[model samples]
Target: MAMLNPMPYEFLGVRHKPNLNNFFGFIYAKVTVPSSVKVPVLPWKDPETEDTIYPRGFFTGHYFSEELKAVEKLGYKVECYIGYEFSQQSLFNEYVNHFYEAKSKAKERWNFEFLTKEEAANKMFYTYAHEVVELNENHLILVSDTTPSRELLEAQDTDSVFVQNPLPQDIVGSGLGQFKDELK
Candidate 1:
């Protein structure tokens, strides 16, 4: 396929500082997708351990960018944020904790199914991405590979669809929590 714009995905800046709530208006207008989609899985049984392997379906990064644009066009200034190494501490600790919990649940719910390390990791990453996306349809958080938060500001790569974490702390600020609260 022909390449689109320099960065087909764009986020509208809501305010000086990133806030989850800031994207609400944009999300209402842009983020629209089915609650559930059929995620692909590979059926495999390890001869050595007789474990069933399950893999999640793949999604494209452009899909996320499009979603964000939809919201931005509706009138929300958002920007993609990425979390990298921090001098203070590991930003991903909280996200890692959640991933473990979610992975455990997935394994149990799938009847003790097994997935390759890569498969498991990808599934967890996508799960978190879905959660973040669900939280704010307008605000787009592109989780790139490790670098620095500042470096992500100039990033223009969309070779992959999975958004890695720990995402920029600001991406899930009060806005996301507020959305969760409203849902509750």
Candidate 2:
């Protein structure tokens, strides 16, 4: 799909550096495996304008801690991404079919709503980027042949975070603690 507003290619902090082929694997690994949350959207009615507002998406976070406490505790690496539900009936049927075939069956299937990679990236960029205050290096980065596999668990270590998984329990408690407080 064409970029809606120009790919925020430089938004990721690590994108500024040179020779990132090695990092691409790391980033892809992070994407293939994520620990995320099902954030609820509460509809709000404007008091004066009386306009209805629909909640867009849920907040999500990785399982790793600043001290790598969670990763160490869980004995693996973890990361997360956000997902949004949007209307896409205008899209071509063949595109929809192809998307369905490519996507996993973990999320609720809505005939008129679907999630896209661009939406996922925007969600993560807005919700979790500022929350990443630190990084830990104690963990070893490993390579897997099936790194692009759809099975979240198989593609990522138990410590890895994901946007969506067949099992919700894997990422129930990885929300942004301080960041959530800030939002409140």
Candidate 3:
């Protein structure tokens, strides 16, 4: 992952308009997690062209707002990169693998579609999303470890990176609010 010019990187998300039946009929997700949807193809025909089936489209934010808005809806709007960071092809792989692994048990239906060098390179919307997951059991655990081990979380390797949190509830750090306070 080589970042030449060093630009700010933000995770993208997605939003899909569910059919009238909701949950596509029959089933429903018990738990919804923030995610990014990257599908290879759609079974339905493209209404716009009236003949094509969305050839391996990678993103879909054009549906509404960008990825950030989706994340904000998830209540994780504050999550963001604090500085310039580099990127690698694997970054995308690591992302989708999460859902793949979780759904692996359902083998025939949920196994991940291994992406190729070209597919990986052909990254699409590259945005954010809120995934629907069904958790029916009594006990549930969410493992939010993005890194390899707990050590990384304890000693986050922020050597050149700094992740910023959302702004606090009452103080305006800029603009008219600051001007009004200054008047006092």
lDDT of 1 by residue, 34-148 (tens): 3232322223345679676532332211113333555445443434342111112244556655755676787679766546676577568657765632545333343333334
State how far residue 84 of model 1 sits from its true place (Å).
Answer: 17
lDDT of 2 by residue, 64-181 (tens): 1222222324332323232111212233546644555545343335433344676566557658676655444432232333343333333332223333434444334323211111
Give the best candidate by TM-score: 1
| TM accuracy, model 2 | 0.15
Candidates' C-alpha lDDT: 0.37, 0.32, 0.31
Worst 10 residues of 3 by lDDT: 20-29
On the 0 to 100 scale, the lDDT of residue 72 in model 1 is 44
lDDT of 3 by residue, 31-92 (tens): 22233323222222455776654333222212212223343454422222121222222344
lDDT of 2 at 144: 37
Q: Rank the candidates by TM-score, best first.
A: 1, 2, 3
- Scored by lDDT, the top model is 1
TM-score of each: 0.17, 0.15, 0.13
